[model samples]
Target: MVIVPILLLLLLPFVGAQWLVCGDSGNYTSNSTYQANLMLLSSTLPNKAVSNTSVFATATVGHAPDIIYALTLCHGDITDASDCESCVAAAFKDAQLSCPYNKEVSTYYDYFMLRFSNHNFLLANSTEDQMKWINLRNTLNFTTGGDSITHLLFMLLNSTAQAAANSSRRFTTSRLGVNIVPTVYCFMQCTPDLTPHDCAACLQVVLKHTLKFLDGAQGGRILGTRCSMRYELYHFYEGVPMLAIPVVNGTTPAPTPATRHNSRKRVLWIIAGVAPLLSILLCVICSVVWTRRRRQGKVNLNDQAATNRPEENELVWRLEEKSSEFTLFDFSEILHATHNFSKENLLGQGGFGPVYKGQLPDGMQIAVKRLASHSGQGFTEFKNEVELIAKLQHNNLVKLLGCCIQGEEKLLVYEYLPNKSLDFFIFERNRTAFIDWNKRRVIIEGIAQGLLYLHKHSWLRIIHRDLKASNILLDQDMNPKISDFGLAKIFSSNDTQGSTKRVVGTYGYMSPEYASEGIYSIKSDVFSFGVLLLEILSGKRNSGFYQYGDFLNLLGYSWQLWEGGTWIELLDASIAKEICTSDARRYINIALMCVQESADDRPTMSDVVAMLNSESGILPEPNHPGYFNLRVSKTHEFFVPCSNNDVTITEEPHGR
Candidate 1:
């Protein structure tokens, strides 16, 4: 019998133990042909990293449709070949287990990184999706000399980036200040294949993201497939810095009086000698360019107009008279405020994209939503928001302070609410205490008033197609403010409802008619409001409410409890102790009424407000809600039914 060594077994757990997995899961099935390719690719990647002299390798397995692209990279600090190989191997195994059937995944181990995807992420265009950022929870703010510390930190980062770009290893470590007590430590790297210019550009991009997101952060990293950056108050990396930044008292030392006088004399002599020659060269070049343009004037006009026409269509928002209430923010200003959309500045991710917390130069806080390029929100939706939301004013609704549009980038700026969203408090077990019964009631009433304004009093008859807890922002005082008008629809005075071939909304919150038949009205909004109401009351997400047992969603579960005379069980325990039984029951009954099977059976927002506010009236009983089954099949095709965690059916539905 073969004997296994005890020492090797003992050391196994210690090898590549510290690591993190990130990136979104791709759509791929398990135990399939593609899955086989992924498994084969993962196995191949570790061996390639071990065998390769550079400790980096990329490989592709299988053909076309089922093809898998895989790559592995070892940090320059990992000098031991065996250790690098072990890290790669561990990353491969962990990535497969952690991400399961995800077709695109990345795992970062202490000594190495392993990434595999069905797409060609090595290309420059695909790098955006492969980017990830990590920020230390701790912050550093020097009370006495803050500017000097900040200035030194950035200088260190910039110098290190330049060194990494020029190095053959495509990696560099840097330190700020002397060995006695360094102000900061930084490490940077890029894939070896990138040219110096490309590597520098990539690092600069991440630096911009860091600037916005890591302003007061003690440590952070912007990790990407092609390039990466990490900095900290103390040395976290394995090796000594390849470069060191000298500490400046303020600026570089000034030249002596004699040296300055000599320098000025030399500068004057050079300028006097070159001025005439420069003037002649400039005139000749300008004359030739003007002659060529005059000759091609007609063709240039036709070509210019053709190209400019499409840009004009995209830039139509610029034509709108800029409102003082909603400034048309410049893209540069937005970048400055949000640190180029740094991940650390991220408040939360919504259906459209990530929202970031930023502060203007004047110290006014703002929340910026940088719309994802691939999101469902298009130019039409952006225009709709700027046109509609800006015109409608309500204290209960979130204020859109401004917007930014430049090239492919689109962003919306709003007044920053410090308490975050309602979901941030209600969904978390510990945080639910921050919002008691009185606060929850206040939130519910505020939402109803916002909806009332949209349906009856606002300038536009708006239907907020997607309404959920996450979309509800809370102020410093915990007052709720309705937000996100991307999916909202406008209704004319004469029209009460609208129909479309495409349906879009959060799964449990979507009205049955809207989800099943692509029809939405003011009543659809009311149905969504009911789902939000139930969520607030129960402190559970309707999307994954299976924890409540047997029930498909919160609506069905609430209905079951109401029927059995055990409805009080649905109240979030945090609030249940103090909530008045009768008042809670009335709110639940009204919520049930809003989610009735037929849209016609649902109350108007105004009526809902009245019912919630009334003290001495017998409310009508609610009927069965639409799609209130105990079981829904997890299986789906085309798009994951629950993937968007919502149904956005593109095909026409057969009406019941």
Candidate 2:
């Protein structure tokens, strides 16, 4: 009992912090003019010494149509110059990425704001002085997300609002112990000019929004227009005491030992009573379902009209749902299906995202993605994928099941394929032996068909911004299915291309036009396919690629060897071990044709399909591929050895 009590006490703070971290987004874009103002204020403030605080920020430009401004602020407790500067710089980098092109972007980090606008910066601080005026306090609108919690949260915010109104420092903080802890933590601030009542009301509005926008977060806030309110379950502010003014009735809530004790007792009794009953009920139900499973007859539901009715994503279920009528799998069903997402079910990892194998309660299998909380980018990617894949349906595409997003927890459910990704056989040291020439040809053709569906044949034309071997999901018979449409783009029927300042795709596989200038089109995808084809032939990645001899990347190396009639040297030794010489040469020539420098020079998907399916067509000698030979050094032995399109690096030679 003594040890347990001591352990509980020590874990209290850590538990609170962990809860805060899990429910919180590592970075969020600031959306209000008040955020812009706060950004300017923080930027002007000098870094301070270590005290009890920190600071944060981000900048935005161009999208929201606002004036340029900058912001910089430290945690109220910060009193050290060096730490403040360092924290501010760190905060700025994070914000810059989160709000890359928008005119009004801001995000919160551990501490500090590095916000700025291409259009405006607020210069309004009290007393005709700039520096000291900016140091008052840093407050943001905290949204806890919902009615009951929101009301209480706003009430606490009013306390800080009232303090800021009465103080000369334009800073005020209030402690609020609510939800899960016993201590209070809340803050409010302004540009040092607003009245107490104005600050109170302004903060209240900001707090309400914060709760709605970031529900269940232990600590989060909104940067707003006139004033801001911030609250965390944990302590966040630090500084010398400022003149204080209370905002609420003098009465504090009465002690609740009786209520808490009753609640605990009730919870224990309920658990004790419910666990056995629920287990018994579940076992009976399972027994019934299993009995039903054995006697159930297969329903003939294969007609396109009968089973593949075109709901928003109805066709996805057609392929993945077996016979339509998508069944909702219980949490336990998925758990049992995947053997609890076991290591043996593990498929692959990228940017730390792991794919697990699962078997449904009905004996159907699935692939589950248990995303990393630290991979904050995965959240947006998840949302983007859900929106797109749910609407896309085609024979060559992978299927997306319903996703699970509770608080910071995120999961992607997918149709499980028995054969796994194409990269497994192409890239692994010994796996290629299983892939004979005939299977390799089928896999290559399947990928082309999938790309055609995305770029032209499907209901919505999509640009699979990222295309590589690993993303090619394989079925039981080794037929290829395109996966990971997270970065894919949709265009109107007539649209053929789009542009993005922030281009993201696998490096070596990107087209010259897309990589060099951020331009993309169906033709751009063709460029990628050509690179993929070359990699497939050689089982080597073009990006960060290196040969033992003088070669920059796979593309350049292939070109060098082909130009010298030694292209056979570039083939995957495994493929070279058995491929038909004529077919292999034809594929190599076609791949080169697809990678021409000019996007217009590349063949259309129609032509690519025709070429791949052809046997007697006279093929032209191909031109040099676009972005042909960018290369790098590979000193890291543990570096990822990518099979077809898995990016690999080569050592940098001393001379050009």
Candidate 3:
């Protein structure tokens, strides 16, 4: 493995001169205003680019016809800021000379990219008109592992693209190894200004175009104005790669012909000499340990039994002390309040259990969630909700009065709201008209504030892994309150994210990273909030919206409308005329930003709340949403039936 990388490095090709593309948007005379503005931006952007953490900067100089929009992006792995500045500074000078008097130009160097144009290409949604270049080293191809090598290369490229899109710098490098082929190194990046979806899309297009010309080449690169990808048999970029996948054990090289006989003889001789002694030693150790454990087992069991009951009592006492109003209800009292758990008092059925409407002895109405004996969510989730929600207090959050754990039954008691959940109104056609623009706006802001509190201001930082309309309860005044903390996760001050092998979340509301990779953070909740916000605005369920046009979900349909400048078409007909267009657009933009493909790209709950409350300010353009192309067949519709029940998925979904 060490020898392979060294040999490949020695065979690396020489770095070449810059590549340039003069745009078709016309040219400027030597002394024109456009030329002067371009000069001004060129002088300042390199310094700005080097100072920025992403090593990228954008500047617009002058106004109207003379305005020049320029962008400078340095290679992400370049460690020294001065090198980045110098590379960018050199690109500006080269662009003017190479494209001579062109008002619009794109220049690419080995270490940086610089582009300026008369038009705002920064706002472009498509890369069709952008510059594209493909470079291939045709001298070598994989003689061994043929199809496997190709598969590995493409897999590396795809994963690299995803990592780059999710990264704050919009850049990533990866390497993978296989015994039949030399280790492959890949580099991928996009301009920082592009949305995560656009970045991924751009790289996908570049890969498709580049693959047409590769034809088993040992190394190749496809470069474009928005995104770029390169893969070679040697490490090509500076610093450690962001991802590295070593070869499987069986894939490692076997002993050579000359060494095979000697290696086998040496291995056999060692095993023969060591096997009998190891077996005898292991048996002796096991016998002694087993005898000791057997003598202590009864004593340990007695001690554990003595301590267990006290610990359980102490835990219950601590929970009661934490919240003064928390009460442990008697099973008989619960049965009487809900009229023997009658159907008339039944509220709704959830993934974990069924809820019942009950009136306490004091005449205060309450909602009782009875945990189902056979639920996938069991005692752990019930206990989690009891501890978590009891400590959290906010106007938009549902109030947990107490809990009851008696025998085999576990029950949570919450202050009941007469209007049920947001899904009851928003999803049903007949009930949709009841929620006007004002009510929807209030509900959206309320949910944002609730999430903000959970993520930032609460006693414990919480990530509500499953947040959807069904989890949002509406009061008599039609105000929203976030409920259901069964799947919530607590984060300490230093923790920013977490991962799990068992991914759990509603299908349409799950973030791309969480659903596919089992990685989640506060951003996962933000993505769910975005889906709920859109549902409120459009009076539609994301999972059920696939029947419309060719779009697979609400996210894709809304994005297309927003991109085409016809976003008004996405507004619910009930509130279309009642709400101001600007407010509606702002809400839609905020929702889109929340549902961005990359978790890093999604706004924090605080940011979401600020955006929701502010009537003015230019919102950032949202990238295409996560799961924009997730397709479900008619037979598989049962997976996401668009009902109130939130499904907990143990197995990872096939795609996002």
Candidate 4:
């Protein structure tokens, strides 16, 4: 029986009280049959054979522990028994942690969701486009394209399956050229380590779902904890990439900015410089005119603020040292780059109003964030961020390129890192493949070191109250730079912890003590770190995890595996290829230890840094993590087709 995760927010709230309940603790919430089925599937799949594509294994867990376990092999890619166990275990952990308490939760964890249903759930044979069409047609006014479309989709699915089945990574993407020259973009991927045919078969299942229900609309994806397939008539991809499509006759656009600028300069120089220099008489006439302009010198500062170059000394705030290597750009230069804050140039809206990318006159790049006056929640954080970053300097910490505050505008500038953030890579399939073992390990270590500096090594003992993936910026080399210091706190060296009536932080990343009781400290950062480590290793998010296997977060699942001596099973497939098995096991052990249920049991950031940097000795075994014992409810979701966010998903709350 397939387990489907459920979403139910049927909470019994007291006027002013919070209650913790679980089977071991003596209080348990009894759920309905439907709830049970949802929870069962929400629990991770115990085992699914990639060879058994016949059994549908789509699972989503709610806040309750109700996911049922099952095994179904994909058509042809079955491998050793070890691969099956690991995939299921990883999937279960993912669903539980990432889709924490929500009722409806679904993610492509490992390959499948071992789930159960309240009613007889029919498995349908469909393609992604067909299902999209069905959903759109039933929901909107649209025409049906008939069996011809379905047949075409089926053929595309088979091709992707065939390719995936042949590759060890078990993933394939292709554009099928149909009769009208319509390109059907299809993508298929199974657990990375899965053998070829299993990948193909697992993808085939998703393809079937796409054709069966969606009915070929604009776009939709059929995703599972294991393998998945996605197709769209529309191009939904956006990122920095070199397209794989080979062109038979078109000239490739120059990939670098320097090339384009050089080409432009070549044309401009001919019009002004070369043309003027060619004639002496014309040059003398121009010089005389220029002399006349020089005679009009000593113009009073009509607008003292309106310097073409914004003065650097005007906005410097309490600087201990200065680094001239980096350019200190003025606000006006930035305004021009973004066309005076044009809505069209805006990249994304953030807590601090909006962030814009800019190009300086000299071709230097920067990211400008204009703090919004209406952002009440962000005001304090924004001021705090500007103050904190100005005082500290480190490679892993985001470099504060400059700041601007003239009149009403409060703009903070940063060295624009081309790769953006960690979230860009971890939640997508196509992108995760590029973050090799070396790169991920570097990111993990850099974050740890950066956090260590904040907590202990910095001039002031600090706590990054808000730590998440989106805050972790990735440089061009894929190096991670921890950012967003607005929520940071300066704690006295002797203080072990603190409490607040108003607690702030992302839900999944927040430690139980902080989230539920307002208690926080260095240990809280440790808890977040543990989650980050798990996410880096697994490429799954901790928040919105839907698998049902009796864990409230990824920490709990990692602890169970470490306790069971199978923690290496949690590694992301892409990371697994290069992982030294022993090191992988050690890393998980350290991560679990960092997330121990009790604050006292968790290691300091310093200790974590030592453990990561030094492979000297065998680390101590980790006990069960705190805050992982909550019993979650579950819900069921019908057959959905497959899709991938080019980057792999991390199991940590950083992405939340």
Candidate 5:
């Protein structure tokens, strides 16, 4: 059975009182600089919000270490500027009293919402702070045509959300009427600053949560930091709805006596027609089931001897128990899908093995990663990826469908992405123009959100030791998904870093400490992300970039331009005209910060995401990047090249 995570308060009636959330970003003393900044924001933010046509305002006060970010948003239905200002000012005072000395506070009132924090949550891409309140007083369900009512409710909500996202004000109200139930008055809104895609995504998330608790309730609402929605039986807002859908085909009227008699005869004829067909269908299903089970039994008996090994037995058992959707494919089935692993079907080859594009009998396309017997990665790495990726569920991470383990053959299956990887478009001159500045920005944000999930949000703390352009796959919509987890490492909640004698990863992406001393941490992954970010921005491969004067790699060349205050020259020619100069500079600053020589100087993935989304705050200056001083030469340098292939390097290296 599935369990819905419903809070206990969901069962109680919503009193429309002020709701508050005290954040865990630590507290400040009354007379501290942080408190003073908070006070200044509280005093000015009300006027700022009232002056705006959208009645929404965001402000950042003070400098680093004591900066305060605050935002106030008045409900879309509230038309009076005085009321909006008054609600916001009262929220600031009430929030301080509710959570004394707190550095982060979120206050929700009936007409307005106020939030202040040391962290910039105004544009953060997360729904962790969503709130929901249900109207338990209305315990009525649409007993008449219940299925149709539920379907109508969802349809209304979905359309309303889309309307809100597309509107200039980012707010919309709608009502739908049906013969079998009362009209549902819907309210949907997002902060005007949000992009249409982000607003829709945020609304969808809250809608799922709200529906789980709603269960066809008469009234309910989900309030989130970025977006919100509400539906009630009675009209709750002041003005008329933007959309009003009339009832259509909701329910059929009762039949007359003569029609009832005819209906009975029709039903009898329909039963007679379907009975024979149903019996034959049942027989066919039983025959198919019997044959399949017999074949599976024979295969199981044949494989029993090979599965006797303890390690293999444990691995198979754990995988089967981990997820019911995890399938154990037969070698014959895979062969049929890939047409005997034909050369034409091959997609790419990696350190682990070759990948092929295949279609199953049911017409589902998949990417099959067939592990080569002599590949550097073996059973341990395969097992790690299968177990780890199966548990991670995120939009930006590739989905693992299943695996196959037969004698001398092992394969992993994933959802097929037609656009291939980031490297395919960014590095190719002809394809560089395909991804404009907006698309590139989306890819960057998607990758950052994926890394943030792996590092802090997922059930298991993970570090993708091999993050690069090739490992980032693009879907049909041009969204990025992080793939290739064979080199990932898991850490406990308390563990911050790890070291090993066996250092492994691509050369240009590895952090200095991880490459020279075999010490790896979350920062190691950040370093790789930094290198990938630069490559995306410049449309040049970092491993072989040697055109600049005395510069060995892209990092050194980028530093030269950055130091000279000519960083705009580092951007790809295609996007240089499309992107704002300020945004390009901000992105370069963030990438440089990620590749800092000292791990302590680099920001965490959380901080990186904030910086990427934040448009107002002053970013910290970056130190010199790692490998920034290296020069190209024929002779061996401090670190010698051990392999011709730049895909991966598994050998141990000496300190520089």
Candidate 6:
């Protein structure tokens, strides 16, 4: 979520008005079959919901002429079993008082919701369901006239919705802290029965409905049969928020000349008023000036960017203070080193720009990433890469030496890896012999450790949104180091997941939830790593087709071979004879486990490492991988079978 600094409206409306109910109030006669079914549903729901481990239950109380369908859902964050039971119990009681004898009704509480209908609503989309809403009286008015604040708020809400859509519990809350407005706390949820994509679509409709009543309000909530969303000034749910938007405090407004003159006038008036008590006035003025200067001296200049709203140059200055090792390279020096941006010096290309191999005057080799000026999101990318990579240090991760910010040219310098990237060796025929079984195993473990550092051991929780073979650089010793901070996302220590609509990543490598719904977490990265792991083990790329099998993509082909017990055929002919059968099979199994369609089913990096180290542990069976159905490209003019490699780079929204 992008935070735009704006004035916050603090006034709140009546608290009791923060609830809504929407449904038909159909009349039903007392002692009728409909009434009996309704009564049975109400009586059975509370105890059934309480007893279920998930604290959620659905039931049908009759058949044919009269039947009632009901479900109770506890908020994903609600942990106390008793609290969930009480909330559902109260919802039942409230429904009776609120809409007696109504056949279809929905009721919402802070931590739980109880809904029932005469129709089967488990798979129903939100559009068919009318929304109930409550909005705050306080308007979120920004002094400036622009859509930045509104865009930021919606981005946060959409991200929260996406998270909920992909989550196992179908619920999530988020915080969007922008410079322009007070922190907006958002929560979104959907019925767990819906698929990830369907849930996302449902929440999208709910979001659109919310804007109708919530526009400019400090906060609001919308409830529906399939979904619910809320944005408030304060946290309204239990547990930690899943997505915490990175705060970007906008530039502070500079005082105008007229304001300075007014301040002088006020000072003159004060002096005139205190002239009769000159001694006391002089003492008061002295004390005020001394205290103000002392406070200013103690201010943290290291993070001046947050308060002062500095430009790129000021950002460089402040960053220099934070880390002396990350030098600010001179433009002339970079020009001299790279031979004035010669084409021969270019190494590879990325989404933002080109990377060139440069040799400095001191004989130090470096890789310089020259960001493209026309790539509208370049500034943010530059800031993110510089700030994030400079703080992270590990043998399996690329090292940021420094950066150059000269006018239109923004360059990031890193220690150049002589072996190019993993793609150069993995996808080429002649280079196949270079990475033997031992080397591939080492490279796989190294990459896993790098991910572990980012997810668990780093100073900040990091998610490498784009993790693929091309982004993994290789050193002289055949060791792998993960690169590309441009697409990386930083999560608050407490946050576990995030989402976005502008999905930026290499296509075939993306997990199902992330590729289809834009929801990402550490598990998303784990999914990408799984693809990479399989690529390393089998000497096959996941994105392209193979000529030997009917399977369209590498994942499907690998699964086909694995299940058929012809797994040995999946291995590269070069390394097959020398590799251990059990070890190779075990690694393949681990890769499959990592690429499970559901994020919750995937193991963490720590678990991956432990599983790899264990000699003989029973591994769980992996479900079908995401995108397994996409065997071949549909838009081919001529079917060449295996010549084309489809690696797409998208301008996706920033992850939470």
- In candidate 2, what are the lDDT values of residues 364-413, reduced to their tens digit? 67788767766433444555566677777876788887665433445678
Q: CA lDDT, every prediction?
A: 0.72, 0.57, 0.75, 0.57, 0.77, 0.71
Off by over 4 Å in 4: 1-331, 342-351, 377-379, 406-408, 548-552, 634-656
Q: Give the TM-score of candidate 6.
A: 0.51
Error of model 2, residue 295, in angstroms: 50
- Local accuracy of candidate 6 as per-residue lDDT tens digits, 502-577: 5667756888777666678999999999999888877777764443365667777778787888878878888889
Q: Which residue runs does candidate 6 get wrong by more than 4 Å?
A: 1-321, 545-548, 632-656
Top candidate when judged by lDDT against the true structure? 5
Sort by lDDT, top down from the best:
5, 3, 1, 6, 2, 4
What tens digits encode model 5's per-residue C-alpha lDDT throughout 1-656?
Answer: 11111222434322457777777889999899998898888889999998999999999999979988887788888768899898788888888987999999877776677888887655454333333233232466656766556656766776677778888889888877776787789888888888787677667655555554565577777765667788889998768777566544656678988788788665664453344334534644654564465333333222333334432333334323433456656566788899999999998775578899999999999999998877656655676688788889999999998887654677999999999888888988889889988999999999999999999999978999989888899999999999999888888899899866566787688998887777788999899999999989999877653556557788988999999999999999999999998899999999999999999999999999999999878899999988887866667253333322223474212110
Task: Please give me the total number of clashing residue pairs in predicted model 4.
Answer: 119
Model 3, residue 418: C-alpha shift (Å): 0.4
Model 1 TM-score is 0.51
TM-score of each: 0.51, 0.47, 0.50, 0.47, 0.51, 0.51
lDDT of 2 at 51: 24
Give the higher-lDDT candidate: 3 or 6: 3
Better of 2 and 3 by lDDT: 3
